[model samples]
Target chain A: MTLAEYKYADTIHRCFRCGYCKFPVNWMDVNNCPAYARFRMETYSCGGRLWLTKAWLSNEIDWSEHLAQILYSCTACKNCEEKCPLRFNVDIFNMIQAARAEMVERGLVPAAVKEFLENVQRHGNPYGNAREGRGEWSQETGIEQYQGQDYLYYVGCVGSYDTRAQQTARTLGKVLLRSGVSFGVLGSEENCDGNEVNALGEETLFEMLAEENVRKFKDLGVTNIVTLSPHSYNAFKNDYAKYDGSFPVLHYTQLLRDLITDGKLDVSGGMNARVTYHDPCFLGRWNGEYDAPRQVLSAIPGIELVEMEKNRESTLCCGGGGGNFYTDFLGGSENSPARIRVREAATTGASVLAVACPNCMTMLEDAVKAEGLEDKLVVKDVSEIVGEVCGIG
Target chain B: MDIIACIKRIPDTSEADTIKIDPSQMSIEKGSLVFKINDWDEYALETAVQLKERTGGSLIAVTVGPKEWDDVLRRALAMGADRAIRVDQDMVAADCHSVAIVLAALTRSLPYDLVLCGAQSEDFGCGQLGVMVAEMLGVPHAALVVGLQEEEGKVRVDRELEAGILESYTIELPALLTIQTGINRPRYISLGGIKRAMKKELQVMSPGELGLTAEMLAPQVKLERLEFPPRGKEAVLIPGTPEESAEHLASILQSAGIF
Candidate 1:
């Protein structure tokens, strides 16, 4: 993939380096770029990375490990796409990713990314766990095995592998079961939906994974999918169609909201908690799903849904996108986006930081511990909260 | 220059919990384990690829394993190797000496200006295969090579020594080097590149095809038992509310005089 291949060869330099792409949607915070916010360097921002990509493509600069590290650090949080004043952000972000795809082709990717891709390639998930255990979370929980269920419960990698995230997966399953919704899981037969793979710039691998998953789904007569992670939802909804995969996909929150609105599910049991929801990057910024989780939260009795200063579209990333949860590329720093977002959540005085995605739950939970706010601020998945009210988990 | 890279596939033992001794008490369970190309072999293959790129030549990657191990060779081909060969063997518990002998016989039959191998395997870590192969092939060998260059029918290599020391040697052509980690960052194997490499020929032959018998290839070593190292100390996970757990931890730390 060349700079020309991203389809931005001619229009790349139209920016004049205004740097508005580094700001949040409100423009009140100019350092919304996660990489730029961490490194505080222009070289790590959207405009600077675009310029570097242009230079490398034109043979003005050689590829180096430092350059790859800088390029890999962008979490693809989509703030740049939201705030770029010139409206050419699609090309700008694609240009950076195209550079990454080229690097992946040339074997010039960072070691962490290489490891992450290799793990996903071999074990069907990023943690490199045995494929047999991929469905272990559904063990004894009585989740159906995709036998003509109304919806296919597509649990993403984190939900299946990470022990902490598995709790949320089971909670979601229990809540859905209690609601009497018909859903079946793929279990060990599941493969990654390739969201992080694509975001990490392994486009070729991502496509192969997506096509394989789509073929499996089609073979099993799957049409409606409800994903446990927003990452999986984003991949199935946005990228899979390029490979002719058009299964109607819904994030779990959307399904829950619908279930609540239709009066099919009850949440009248009053449970009190001052909880603030962190919008996952893929669910909110990527797909523009700003209200599903909030509506679900608002419907719950005895739940005080507080809003952070940065909410909905302007929400800060959890630094878990782009395979950062496995790579930890932006970790070991106070300024890492997840740590920063935890601090922001603290400002709202919310006792619990509720998350809809497993990736966000795992990332923000760790951030809570790293920030030493675990006692004051506990992280809970939205499904966990629902499961509690349903008297299941 | 023509190069031959010897690679291996081993269980990814990065996670300690994934390892379990088999019922035989001599091997790890294989049913639920994940396998990958040895970490060190990546640097070895990358070294061969880099050398081939600098000077126009064909790179051949060889591994001594079963048909399933051909994926590692395919990975090598994707990383810019010209050819891949797998010696058909399924000796999961085979000693390093048997693999070295088989590799030596295979390398003797291939066209090669230089031979490369990883310094050690993640599972075995014997660090003896390359030297044994060199001894059997009667070629000069360098171990723990972190740097390499080809200069006029000879190869110069930097052998990493203990305590951050480097011993450089310029060995003649037709030599072997066991590459150390950080030799050079290995290239990513793209799915597209691998798909393209899938069309390339992956030659497979048995030890008998290489003029060796099962008796001659028999392992000279045997393992009697395997056991995990005993735990030194265990932290008690207090199961309770956050406040109760914090209090328990605080009491433990206070009694230990750490607070």
Candidate 2:
């Protein structure tokens, strides 16, 4: 492909290797980018990846598996966009995504990525599990199929299929029930939110998913959506607008925060523990809703919320974004972002590492076990923690 | 060197729990199953594509199945096959010999210096179709081919045997080889590539088009009822201290004559 055919041709060369994209918001270290942290190589950083993308587009370098790896390694965490001093910072993530789109168009990508997209295309989930079983997680939990209810409890692909995440999904359902929220779940009828699909640069596939989901939601008369995953919230709140899917969507944490403040749910059964919150990139940076989760955690009686060095806008990703939770390009290393984040959480002396997103929950939970910090640290979803205090589930 | 690759589509039964004997009692339930190119067939296609890349020849992917099987053919075309052909048939219940007859007839009609087939299908796993086709076509053939290299007028291949042993042979042109998995890493078929493949040559023909009838392609073997094996005893966990568990395990093994 030539520069003329590339989507980010004009601004592709604008990244002059500023190097700020590698640092956290506090500029503590140059390991903010998860890929860069894992490999500690310039080629894995956001700016380095852009340079390689420019070279590949300009024909200076050929498209190899390595090039695809570098580009796909980005978590789309918006960390560079958060820290870059340039005026074109907003388009940086888009530029990388465009490069991935080119690779997808050329029929070249990592094998695992291909499997991920195909699974989503065929089975409506990345696990390639039977779609008939998507609603099985809600079995015996009394969650009903969506029927023009007040809210559609959108348990995304992870919550629907992943065993551990399903617990959080059920817990959140019970919490909503305890709050007496008029909500129903799509269950088997729910499709992928396509956040990771769009991030992975499968534009056409993402469009198909977005269009199908919008049609399904509209047909069901869904006006309000509360998603179990921030990834779905990002897609529904921002990406779905292009398809005229303008439903009022809330990440479950946002709803929980409101419920606790309004006394709709009782959390008076206090649990004594020092807790640290890990800001999911989609929730904190992509959508800029940093206060909701923190507010919810603070409202719980006797719970002490501590701040890690990297929190909120500058928080490091769990290395699970951009389909990396499945592809896992940045895994299996001590320097992996999840391991680093867990160690950071351990340093805060918090026994609990609280996560709001299912992707974060799975990634960090595994990282804790891998780091062998299971004794000192435990990973719990915000919903699970709230469920404990609320005496639900 | 024109290449012909025989591929098949099979239901994904990786999640073994999902497999259930259908009401027909002759096949597994496929209503909720997702399908994909047979694993070994994908390796065969990759090997063919690689050979065609090196030898500067055309690759054609062929399958014998219903219209729904065009998907695997499209995947082959996306993986750089010049053309694809599907012989319309629902041979899922047919024996290996019958399917091989249809394949041999189709192979006879195509221009092929080399014919490739997956050693087995994921569904049936007969491991006999490719050799049977070669026998009918009257050509030199190799089975369980784990490695391959092209020469001027022949190809050298390594056939896998038991105990990790490899047997090598140099077969002349117009030969057939049943591909084993791990011969090559199959390239991923992108959605864009699948869209492009839609414009490629995908010809659909019937068994009669190849001058073969049902009687000519009748199976010598017949499939009986399909049933799951009876469940074995549940695992027994020895619950005690390590030494006590070890003593109990020794007594159990002694009782089972494992000593």
Candidate 3:
């Protein structure tokens, strides 16, 4: 294969292996990349993955399951983009995604990734759950279907299917009700936001999903969307524009921040608890809105908001981005990024680990259990926190 | 060698709660249900595709269903099947013997050294279609095949038996095999691949095209009725701390004579 065949051919060779992509903002450690953190090898780091991608494109290496696992293990957290000192740092994550696109085109991805994508393709969710049951979580919550509402509450796949994430979905619905926003949900009609599909490098499937969703939204006259997961928010705000799906989208935290500031919802029934917020990579580094969730948490009376050592732009990913939550390539080890992140949250001495993304909620919740820190830390979505303080369900 | 794989499309009823008996009492309600290619047939397609990859051959996928069933054929084409053929018939209510007759007639018209089918449909695990087709085609066959390897004019296959036992046999050319799950991991069929496969050859034929008629496709065994299973006792939730819940569960089990 020639260099002309690859997307980033000209800039691919510019990486001199500076190794800073493996470190957090504080430069305290070389394990910032979740895959690198799990394997403790240079091959799993951003620089290592870029080099491997170059080799594979240039025919220096053969495609293997091990190589696919290495490439798919990247969480697309943008921590490398956050920490890399090179001018080409912005394209680092995209380069990896491009490589994955090549692997996907060759049908050479890992088995679990294949399962994940197939599930999403067949069932409109990663769990292979029935699409008929997508709206069952909102049955008792009294959330109406989306119909020319001011804001279409777009709960992505994880929030719609996963058992635990469903609670956050409902809580956000209840919280939205308390805020008196003219919002409605898509319910069973909602489709996968295709954020993870794009991240996983299935560009065709992603485009199909985006086109279908954009058509559906346009038909429904949806002008605004507030998403439960930052993954969806990032997709709608950034990737969907190419398909003429440029809607005014907000992460739920940003909506809640405005709701709190405008006194639209009362939180006088606040309960005392020390909380530390984990910035979802999509919301923080991917979109740059770190202060909204913190401001919302700070507005709640009797709640103490703390920050972990690696917060904001340098936050440690829970290893759930880029479809990793479902594929789980970085799972089943002490060195897993979720386990490492919960440990970091625990070190801050905060009892509550507040998260703004449903993916983070599920990942860190399981990590807390695996690390046996259930008694020390509890993972709660920021919407659930606001629901409690506002005395809503 | 040329291979022909038989596949079926069935409603995804994995979620038990979504299943409801239709008013006709002969079929389950599919109003809100999603459909996919049968799980076992996916294994068969993978097996056929792998065999074709190993030896130079054409893999043809055939299904007996209505036009809505073209989705599974497209998926087969996406999984590297060289061509697809759909016998336009609604065989959902047809007996396995009748379906087998249709498949046998279809397979005879094509040039194939080997024919593959899933051990059974996920909705109805009769496990008889492939063997019946083999009998109608007058060829040697194996069922519950978990492993397969191709040789000159013959193939060796491992058949899974009762009690985790495996039986092996070598069948000569022009044979059939019923593929079991875990035979091979099916490759992921990307939407892009499926889009490309849409441009491939997908031929539709009536039963007459295979030289078959209503008389030859008569069902030998008939489906009586469909009914939901009786609901058992509601599960008792033991709510407490772990130790307390464990003790409660133990006492409940002890009282129930579960030891």
Candidate 4:
């Protein structure tokens, strides 16, 4: 490709294909890049994609569904960016997303991806359910719609749509009320955070969603937004600001951590369980929120908090990011990263694999069942743990 | 060359869980739902765009709906349609015949070398409007057209049939063709593209503007109450290893007497 055509052509050249992006910090294993780890192919890695992208842009290769799938397979977990020693690590993920944006402009995306985007376009959420149902879960959950409340509970698409994740959303609401935290939910008024939309390469649609949400938040006078999905938290906390949306955002785990630290809620520690926290890629690596979830988990009196070898920044992805949950690119295969993550979590000897993001909760839960480890290990959201400990669930 | 593409706005039922019968039981409750260009209509719009690109024609998109349907027409404009038209109305349940009458009236007024329409509307699936419009206009018609090619004075089409069969036919120019799905990959319109197309010609006309009274456009058929199908057998979630699941599925197939 011409140097001027690609946005980060210079930085992309700086990659020099060192291959460090395919390993963890410990380098004990090589399956660090989730797509590469799953595919066992060089073409799926960050550097390989970069080379392919250059060739395709330069007209050396024609675009194919295979190339698009490889590009779309990335979860944008940032593991490759994290492990890369190059100074242009930040450009790596953005470059992949940029390439996807180009592919979207050309209408060369996967069929599932097309359906995913068309749904997100029609419905406010990616699930394609009516917007009315988005607010239906807040009923009977003691969560009121925001009317100048202290914080707006911005339940992202998964929590608002998926039945299993709805429990986590409700639990978060209950936990907040029990701790006497002042919060109100946007309910149906809350739009998709457009984080995954941005990652999926619908830049224009993402901009529309982000702008509309920001305008609505500004109109509501919302100062803080607590999200049940790390996907939304990442977008609200970081990406929104780029569009002139400056609002404080916290993953539910961060707020739970704060509540426990303030001693506002009483935990009898009545029930005991062995649990390990699954650091969501968006929460931990994308935003560097390693301690908040862990600190809250540690404070629970009846819990034995353990760690998997691949935890925190070096954590394996749930293979649900970048709209992969709806795309099913990672499922139906043993090499699915979520299955790999659950199998690793099983090694920690913990019965419950706790997660902070709704996307992660769904991914790992299915992965547990797919790997036939559901009987041995269960997946639960971090809020579920707090709900259990506080006798709220 | 001139081409006219008929489109419709329909509530997305991709996720059927949220769809419900309205209080009147005649139509779906679309107040909280999202509406989009009908799926087959999207393919039709793409087909018209592709034909215009290759044959150097002015493509005009037309829809029969209320004011909110302008979004679909705007999208059509962004997809390279030279202009858009909306037959404004206030019908909650439009029948295929009524819509065909309106579309045929609109088609008669325009200078069109060819007419294209979706095989069926998503919500109704009547599969009648295109052929009915063609009959009213007294033009040759091709339905379920999976492929099309322009000739000197005619258009050749591959009509889809049941069981993956295809029937080829060549219809004369100035005829109507109802496009099937996968005729082409529809282009994605950026928000910027739509914003730019907002400046394009988008004409809105009521039935009165077409010299048609409310009675002339009234639906010939009235919809009865809609209800869900009766549940017969309960569905069981078959969860286990792949081999076990396969064995379970084979038994299920056998119970249905397929083997």
Candidate 5:
């Protein structure tokens, strides 16, 4: 049997859907599901989805039109798998996405997904905006393109396109340049890593984009790839190989941590402010990359690395995974549990909120602003804080 | 129809911390590298078995990990799969591209109406193997198969899209389909089935058997090293007068976003 068939036939045949893997309390850390932490419903929990998938497979349950909607509810956070005592590989979100893809092939996916896919296929981005003006952030910067630079900082779709995220991209560029790390931009030739596409279950399109990005990276002869977003880092580090290209991938902080560790970076002035680092889900949980950024923070002279109750592998989600940041699908904006996490970070008595990923920055920054606590604390990426300490700001 | 389902033996990520490693990175504290069915593959396997019940077919399981994967393969068999296949060589590199190439070469001779896979593996999260396999086999693929319908001379399918969207298409026979989650709930292995699976046939092969050279297996992405994330300072709860504690608590809660 082919690998695809082998995996499918193998997984479905083995999964029992006993619901033993799910957490009893949705918000409990012992339970690995972030969605349930917010939704507090069996329908949105990993075990519930597993049972539903088993029922559908057994012909005991029929696919209603709403089946697709139910499948997309998960963030694919892998929290439930962590909670499972039997080690059931309960990938309800990802598997549901694959199943939904098959259903889409048979005209089974929700209409919204169909439209989004159509746009992505046409526009080279999931958001379906013009690709011509993609890298507007680099337009005014002195940075050039693919000039045999040792590091090629690939700003992702959101960093390049979204206006708010543009600040993050620009800030990252400035910090890298200030630190004397020679880096170049991908500019218009850049494309989505198909990270979100794969996450959302559009594997074919994800492949196409991955292929394009791989070709571009190879053509540039770029040795090292540094990204502003952890999602992009996770994809390039883990997913790029599927498309036949590979590079050492790092989020900006990882690279900065290396620079700090090697004594390439030295921040002289003592800030005396305590800081708390919020772990991005993709960086921490998805790939087990939780250290380098904090190491950089630790090496700094006077910054105290304050811990939140939920941190590292147990860090609470900022409610931004699975494209939830673009839309409040779960109504987290009105009643955000992540804001509570932000509040938790605030309670650490830290003057600054140190973040690694651009998404975390965006979410926590907004949370800080929304709670009107901007006067008390500030949200900054580790790179940004390092840049400031180095007198680059 | 005869279908073979490919699975993997992944270290349980939940207890990944429990997997203690020495500084050299060799397995020092030999905790269980627990075996479970690959997540997406489970969906694929369930789909194949269910499709077999409808269209009539046999299900065979496949994997490439340590010999211990036989336990997982047996679990698949216990859940109603027919047989098992294992590639019995120490896989040095964990890169997806290399793994896919090896898997494709191994399955080149297998017979089936369709090939199914999860879009990506959970452990590595690389959604490339199924597509790479299709490229190797010179077959059309409909990945992220959210919907499926059998048709004359071809199969109709639905591919999941972003924001709750899906696209409908049709592909000819012998095409690859990457099964998504939620298509079907996978079956649980009964104790009786597990006993029965113990006696089933299991085929094993090595990398050399598949003509994979060390150069081909070399991983493009290197981890360099793994570091533990920095720990936050212990919360120093202020204890004393309400006013003093509240003032202190206010500062702490202010940092934690109590406001």
Candidate 6:
């Protein structure tokens, strides 16, 4: 909207609008693009959207209601960007969403995205609970008296508040205890990392969150951030720089892997379940962290690690990206595709479903439960698995 | 000790092209997925190699994927996995639960003192298999292991607990463990390791080889849809200088009763 803003958008101008970013032409099967899959329209594809951006810039297409809908229709999955010949980044889709969100704030936002944003701001979470006890998992563990010193584990909003993901937090704590790494947690005062706000293009609220967190980190002398959620990691890794706050950022998987390799942690006995891993979009695609968690799985004796058909770079969206976890959409069920992903992992004949990010854990766990596969498939975090195996009871 | 590290091949997440979605016609675009080591598992492999050097163990790497994953397995070998295994089949059923079943079965067929994995894979985020495998094998397992020491006929581990809390556990040998980052500095596979891994054995398996079946892998879960979360509007930036910003922040917090 401003000259400076135009300069920022210029970096994205090099996109050739080629659709190759989402899929290769030689794909023998499997039609990609969830949006295109749903709508059967080029406007929903990354190429079409990129062209729309170009059109807006060239004044060929006015920024109108139609344009706003086209922008909002994107899930910000960034999958389309992969197939583009020029590798045009699809984060622009998110940027467009953010820009439109700004207009929506001025009573210009289409009637569509209004309720979802309101819920997040009011609830301090997307799930619509004003007094959502985010740190309830820590309470359930009954490990209330342990005063740890080496690290301060920050379970993002999803991990702490989301009931499904809380199991991961508790499991992580238990695993860390078994491994003997002194760590602490903020029983309270851990607010949202402003990730959803920031990603929603609400830079102002995001900054408020950044400043507040900087204050909290400094107040607590927080030297390191151990997060279980990649969404939190992305916010910490990329957005924290905006506030000039730098700390050692490690996904819980990365840190735990290091401990296991250093002769600081040990495993005893073996397991009899075939297992596969699913990569979270933020941890894998948003950030290039692809090794630590699997390495941990592979380190165990007698266990086999398997890959999914859509894995790592080619992973399917669990319908939770860009705060989709909180919104209501009439499209296909959010839990079905991710459940299908879980089934893909299940198809490997592995008994356990492994994951890293809390959001993914929450979504997939629900999918598993919804599909009534709880008895056949057990959902566990890498930390919980390791904790149980460390022989600490 | 010969250490077999189980790894996985996955899509590259940071690059935009790697993610896929089922289209209207149920067609997946080709090459949209770029394969790599499962993000967390790569860290596990690096950790295993490092531990092998320090504690004296041979690192064997393994993964279950179509034969296309041989390159990634080879890359793991290049990264210092002494040996690699590939479950080369259409692993559509390789969800957290089914994969665990297969892995548990395969591990029973081999001999190992320890096992390691990333706390969770980046995609699924289930974070379960490590413990579930331990449960299935009846092995004592630990996650978030930041420290470990093998002593006289026993293993001692310092786990990274939540809230910065820690507790120590000691276990007997022949156990499974999933790793967390920051436990140790994972070493990059030197060119020598890569070349050396080339000489190592890389084996493959099918569901039948692992005694697995689709009936046993009935997906207990399903994702109904994938869509962007709703958004209301842009944040109202109450801009000011730092001091003014603080004052304004205080007012907002006060108004919201946060302070």
Angstrom error of the Cα, residue A94, model 2: value is 2.2
TM-score of chain B of each: 0.88, 0.91, 0.92, 0.96, 0.80, 0.82
lDDT of 4 by residue, A1-393 (tens): 353687877766566777888887778687877888889888988888888888787777888989988999999999888888778887788998988888877666888887788777877787778777788877887888898888998998999989999999999899999999889998877788899989988888999999999999999999998889989999998899978899988888888888888888666574488899988899989999999988888887778999988888788888999999889776777888998889999998999999998888888999998888978899988888888888887
lDDT of 3 by residue, A77-177 (tens): 99988877788889999998999888787677898988788878878888888887888889878788999989999999999988999999999999998
- Model 5 lDDT tens row, A1-393: 222442354464455545544432244543335555566677766666655655565567787655665665565555555445553364445565666555544334454554455445545555666555577778776767866799999888778877767776877787777668888997877777667667766666677788888888888788998998888998999888878878988888888888777767776564678999888888887888889888888888898888877677667777666655553344445346457666888899898998877666777788887777788889987877886787654
Candidate 3 structure quality by residue, lDDT tens digits, B1-259: 7999999999887677888899889988887778888999999999988888888789999999899999999999988999999999886474898898889999989999999999998988888999999999999999999999887889999999999899989999899999999987777788898999999999999999889898887767778899878889998889987889999999999999999
In Å, residue A271's CA in model 2 sits off its true spot by: 3.0
TM-score of each: 0.91, 0.93, 0.95, 0.91, 0.57, 0.54
Report the number of backbone clashes for model 1: 1
On lDDT, the stronger of 1 and 6 is 1
Quote the true-contact fraction of every model: 0.75, 0.38, 0.53, 0.53, 0.00, 0.00
Q: Is the docking of candidate 2 incorrect, acceptable, medium or high quality?
A: acceptable
Instruction: Find the candidate with the highest DockQ and give its number.
Output: 1
lDDT of 6 by residue, A1-393 (tens): 532354336545666655555452345223345454445567866567666766665667776766655655555556665555443354555546545444443333333444444344434455534323556678756444224466778887777777778777888887776667777777656767877666565555567678888778777777777887888888888889779788778889998889889977786465656778887777777787778888888888866888777767677666566665654231355334466566677777778888887767776777787666877777777776776677433
Q: What C-alpha lDDT values do all the predictions have?
A: 0.88, 0.91, 0.91, 0.87, 0.71, 0.66
lDDT of 6 by residue, B127-199 (tens): 8878787888888888877777777556788888789888799988777778776675343332223445678
List, for all models, the DockQ compared with the true complex.
0.58, 0.46, 0.55, 0.50, 0.01, 0.01
- How many clashes in each structure? 1, 0, 0, 0, 69, 199
**Model 6 segments beyond 4 Å from truth?**
A1-17, A24-34, A37-40, A53-75, A87-101, A104-116, A140-148, A328-331, A334-336, A369-376, A391-393, B1-259
- Report the C-alpha lDDT of model 2 over B131-233, residue by residue, as the tens digit: 9999999999999999999998999999999999999999999999999998976776767678878999999999999998888867677788998889999
Q: Which parts of model 2 have CA positions greater than 4 angstroms off?
A: B92-94, B163-167, B235-259
Off by over 4 Å in 4: A1-5, A268-272, B17-28, B89-94, B108-111, B150-153, B206-219, B222-259
